[model samples]
Target: MLTKNRAASFWNGVRMRTLAASPDPDEPPRMVTVPADWDQDAGAAFAAMAPGTGRASLADASMLWVGPLADHPQASHGLATRLLDLLLRRAAAPLPAVWHGLRGSAPGFVLNLAAFAQPEGGLEIDDFVQACETLAEAMHLLQPSGQTPCSLLLSNLDACLAALGLDYDSDPARAVAACLCALATTAMHPHSVPSRPGASAGSVPPASPVPGLTRFALARWQEAALRGRRSGRSPTHELLPETGPIETGLTAPGHALASWTDALLGVEACGAAPLFSPLRPDGRLAASTLARLAARGMSPEAALAASLAGNPVVAIAGPAATETMHRAITPFLDRAPEAPTEVQAPMRAAAGGGRRELPARRSGFTQKATVGGHAIYLRTGEYEDGRLGELSIAPARGSPVQRGLLEAVSQAVSLGLQHGVPLESYVETFAYARLGPGGAVEGDEAVGSATSTLDYVFRTLAHAYLGRSLPDQPQNAVPAEEPDDALLPLDLPRETHRPSGPRRRHGLRLVG
Candidate 1:
């Protein structure tokens, strides 16, 4: 704690000085240059909003972040000092409507800022607009040939990976890919950075004149994106050329940062959201401070800035450019559920596949159970070793949404079983679940009137797999040896059979 305070005191002062000295560009840079005063403006605003008591407040958090950042390898990318300037400032700012409803941002959930594009503190709309142009130029792939700052950077990274004998396609190599992009965002000057049109360094702008993303703004942005894409048609040289990854020139922190970068980003980095969460997206560092940044630290501005390095990384591109990256990244930013199999598959593939192996299982066992007076078919897949591998539950007849939910639950259960979970664990979770339809069961003697379908299915599984006896329902408790069907008239649909397939699959098409 003492070292943290001292370091915080020192680095906070460093940021104030560095940003204090950098005057805003009066005109566009001869080449792409990060706005000099952005740090100063952001820093000053932070002091106003997240002001610490006495001499300790501002610098304390700054130091808290920088001390560990200074130990990473990417620090040389001009990050620690600038990022300290950005994150501290933005964290002090309010969360946007897009991010307003987050459940929480602790170690559990990966914070995602989707729903709409969010413009955070310390950046001008014009500057942000310019970034969109650059991003769109580099990302749009309308034609086969072109040189975008992004494409060139990718090409350079490709060369680096080849020279280093690293595989660009490898999971470990993704961090390297993302780092290269961050470097380029810094090195490439914005095509044009107009003089200030808003408040100065340290001041907040007036409430937006237009509340939401207006049609005019969207159209202008689209045009800019088109121009950017056209320019990158053949890899223009206007942007500065970077030769390789942070191979040698990095300082110690820069090295550590680089190491973390590799560890953090990858096919798994999509963890910016739920479907693509990594166990430790920010890189599980040995140090407590870095660990906090990785596990507890959540900032959209910082996320954008770190991704961009020179600025911040919010999504952008041509017509599809922004959304594609967003669609790719959205699922990753938010935290996924504790149940691994509960994720949306499309998102996982889009963000990049999960880090852990999701082994496939087919129980080879199909059982019929009744819930809510509706028949449900529970199919289980097991591993060759006889452990449950996967599950599927289809209602004899129901809406797609209903069937989808059942299928999702079964899959989640199957995943748990295959991953070394005991049937008892599942029983503890799902037994007596109280939602959806619940009623008397005509078959499956272990259950009587289930409170919910999940209740009946789970209890049945417990009896069939775990050798545990079913709990007695006061109204219809019967000995295990008795046939539950005896309680019902023989005319009712039997729970033992699947309803005819054609009609079961042909229910309502679109009614909600």
Candidate 2:
């Protein structure tokens, strides 16, 4: 049932090149031309890749293949291991191996670099730098065909920052990023350095060079990222030159650049590759971005800058990242899908927050009752976690105007609850309102009486969700009857003479 294009995408993700195909047939093709050395296991590996994504694999048509990077021995921590397992399971393709093959490589591979941190904090700078080195070495040795440009994504970055005992978004994390980049890039691109008998003390040695392995090159989008941040504006392709290498901030040993400038540059003055992190698909932050930065008390701008300074460990926002990758693989993609544009990209809430939608099949209950003899129906909806998410009130008996008003009020309250408004706020505002439909016994046992329907609704919610009870109002008192003589004044009224036309009358007339 797989379409030829979909199948091709799967094969591409698994690194199996399709050399040729048979003439069109009515049914899906069983076989196709591939490398003689192609491992059947590799092809099988992608059969269930990202199955939940409704595609053969994430690499199939994704702009950037992003996932967490795992250590060789695997993480000793359960949480780290479980997360890695989940990501790899969803991705289906194995690291390094999925990146292999002479036919072609992925447009880019984003490795979640933060996965290397220990769950229990206290990760030292040297240990982290060594971990980066180990990863670079392992990747280089595994994938002899170095066509794939791997990016170490700093997703879940704050956790790693915590492990390092560094404050989030502080200068310390940036400093560590630069140091790690210098050491790791040296390992990934050793040929850039001249031959020497031995590495100097405290200097990170380069790994043996691999043929066709490209030195770290800045993606076009990364330069735009730097420009955008520096100018405090969004960068456009038009503003970028057609041809030029971005200054990688490399400096001479005796240069007059200030110490702050050197630290800010984040790279050593060597002919080493510049590290840059790719943005998420369509230039939006990934779920991991929120977790790594915002939730951890870091800012997006800080993460982007750290990424630019030779730490391939951060997933950042950039105008060019997606466009550049799209350009690289467009030829292989099916023509039906349109390339993502900045304007067309979906916007998401930032600051480590996002809308949590309710499930399609929701759970709820309706309560029928009367408040102050005004019949009402109350309904409630809950989230998967059993939290209240929606509420609706309907009057069983009322004027058309009253019904409409109640409907509108219910909708407004429901919207607020769905948008994360607390139940307590509604309770405080409406629980004891003395409005029409005032004073009543409700069918519901929880609330025996209420000043108004809203009072009943909120009081019910308070009891159900807030675990608090409201006391009923005091009973109304009866008034005493007054004597008829009480209406008379205490003193007798003076009589006034009427006009001559009126005969003597016993009735007294009041003067004007």
Clash count for candidate 2 is: 5
The residue-level lDDT of candidate 2 at 231 comes to 62
lDDT of 2 by residue, 381-490 (tens): 67788777766566643433565577567656765676577888989999777767776665788888788888898898888888999887654622334433434446
Q: Which ten residues in a row have the lowest lDDT in candidate 1?
A: 106-115
Quote the RMSD, in angstroms, for model 1.
24.4
Model 1, range 312-360, lDDT digits (tens) per residue? 2211111112122223211211111122222545545654653333232
Off by more than 4 A, model 1: 1-363, 443-448, 476-512
Question: Mind sharing the TM-score for model 1?
Answer: 0.26
